[model samples]
Target: MTDATANTAPAGAGQGSLLIKDSRTAKRNGAEGRFKMYGLIAVCIGIAMLILLLTSILTSGLSAFWQTTIQIEVTLPEEKLDKSGVRDPEVMAKVTTFGYAPLLRDGLEATIAANGIETELSAKDAAELISDESVAQLRNRVLRNPDLIGQTVSVEVMASGRIDGFYKGRVTYASAERDTNISPAQLQLAEALEDKGLLNTSFNWLFLTAPDASDTRPEAAGLGVAILGSLYMMLIVLVLALPIGVAASVYLEEFAPQNRWTDLVEVNISNLAAVPSIVFGILGLAIFINFAGLPQSAPIVGGLVLTLMTLPTIIIATRAALKSVPPSIRDAALGLGASRMQSVFHHVLPLAMPGILTGTILGLAQALGETAPLLLIGMVAFVREYPEAPWEGGLFDPATALPVQVFNWTQRSDPAFVERASGAIIVLLVFLLLMNLTAIFLRRRFERRW
Candidate 1:
């Protein structure tokens, strides 16, 4: 009767009721809520940073897709361009770009006169607004169509980099006064030209199609060689790494004896995955260039180096993919009178194809952006000429990659090159995004459920 009375007293008499709030529970809930808030804050910070970075890249880089150009009608005197009445190709070639320079200057002066624009700038200064690269363009145009030598044809040419920067808001009149390469009068003349509808910014396809230009001629620089070199290297990587990495993974996972040798190989592959890419560059330099006699700065050498660096990743991803296949699938195939090789190839491989493709593409994308190994192989050299078609053995030719091009441009003293470097970064980022999107699409499209 005494124990029953004690137990039947108010529920909170001896200890706190389980349904009621306790100090420890309240503290624990507060901590959990604080943790959630912290996590939310961290996520927001990361998202904001990403938005800021992308905004910066887009703001600086998008302008590179357009170029400043001036259109003028140049009276190409037959005597100066084509001395021979017959307009012989050899004779036309004898006239240097220097000889064509005065013609362009005269054309500019004539344009100013015709447009009724007033400027106190001298004739030479007026011509200075035109890109020095234009002289070569004019000469090439005449050479291509010798008949146009005698006619007053409308020739459109790039404006000087300074004038271009003016349109892009990179240059100001006050700043031009302090600049040695360009003058206030030149900017005034450029402004006048624009007012007269003779100078304007247009889409710059050459930025993608033309080759790299010299530091002095940043107005004419482009990414043609870098693009081709990168494409070639990626092709090589996809071709070589896919088959070799897959075959090796299959043998290790499905056929090879589970022994020390295989274990050692697996360990080595994992270690290589973590090795610095520059180490592979060093290895490539010694073996490919020094011992194997492959040419320096050749895309072939870069491709081979990238292939080596990419293989370990491909192998690891492929092995994971193979292991993900259900063991029952193998049993089902074996029950249908299939050999070990037949089961893997006909049954397991099909289900794993999506993962294999995703891994291979991601590996290629990584190799595409890698600059260290390519730089070590001498691919950072200035390459002005585009590589030939693949069937012509162009893989062995000297070339630069997109990343190396960005590195090269950033090293220049010109502010224009900095803009170019940013633009190149944008291009590289676009390619990477596309590749990643493709990986995601493939994974979703071909993914199978048990």
Candidate 2:
């Protein structure tokens, strides 16, 4: 064949090859476009789910922050709260909440009469419209300070949970017919009082500051004690877990010889991360409570349990961070005759601090929302009194953590406790959110590029 003819044949073969390559490229690009679309759809679904969750929580939990209060202008009788007209503790002890109820009823009745809001409700029904704890609250004030016994002071008392619901439009006349704590007539009287401004609904700061009360007094119940308990537990976890976790990571990553033992330990740490949290609860119960003889429901025990649960998480993150550090940096330090500890601590650790902190905070956040381990330690029990002190009560006293408190509230027979439970959840979420945001901030602040 001629040379030109042979060249043309070769060119034709090359053109065929180009066509095949173009077709494959087009098919690959189409597949990539479809994958991108799938990712976008998944992200949209996630955002929609988050929005729904927040809306539901806000709608159900918002009512717990505002409570109906009956403003009573009462003349504190000297004989009731302070019989001796002196600040005597013995005399105050003799008087009970019942003794203070009549005085409160008379004051409320007088206020109603003065307001010209005529109702056929008896004094007992009128007092029932307000909170039963109001009497005890006033009596406690007089017992604390006898100077206020004869003074006419205006006290804003919480209304009964049912009455409060009535004012908030949660309980209607038809619903009152089936309710035992409130009747249709009582709701009607409450509305009348609300109209005259004697009873009104406002934001309740007490819910954030006061301690949890009985189921009958949901309006008075607060998550403050639980919040403090969780704080103490977190403090213990932070102090105990961070150092131990970092130390283990440092030794494993920089100094420890890679042997079968080390490999086994690494595998077990990873496995522990995936273990069921309730299993940790069981372990904590058997080891800490039964064997160690630690106090039941103490924040210290809860902290120790959480520490065990959190250590694996921190260690994994820390090791990953240490691995991310450039070997060149370590070599440079060593070439300058710096000791191994100095090189690791001064250069490597500072670089890895962000990741370590992020991991630690994330683990703590997980511990904060934990309920099962706390339940095993008796943190689910009813605790009315505030803990004495961190050092005094933290190790020995019975305390309820926030998640356990929320769980306890949900199991109550009263509907108001459900609202309180939702409120407690909101508080817990806020705490978790704050911790997560802190982790993000630290990560961004201290992150280094190799």
Write down the lDDT of every candidate, Cα atoms only.
0.90, 0.86
Model 2 stretches with alpha carbons more than 4 Å out: 1-22
Per-prediction TM-score = 0.94, 0.94
Q: Write the per-residue lDDT of candidate 1 for residues 1-450, one digit (tens) a residue.
A: 333344466776436555565565567678889999999999999999999999897888788888999999899998887767788888889999999999999999999999998989899988889999999999998888888977898989899989999998898999998998899988988888888899999998888888899999888889999999999999888889999999999999999999999999999999999999999999999999999999999989999999999999999999999999999999999999999999999989989988888888889899999999888999999998888877898999898999999999999987888778888899899999999999999999999898
TM-score of 1: 0.94
Evaluated against the true structure, the overall lDDT of model 2 is 0.86
Off by over 4 Å in 1: 1-19, 22-28
The number of the candidate with the highest lDDT is 1
Q: Relative to the unseen true structure, what is the Cα RMSD of model 1?
A: 4.7
Against the true structure, candidate 1 has what lDDT?
0.90
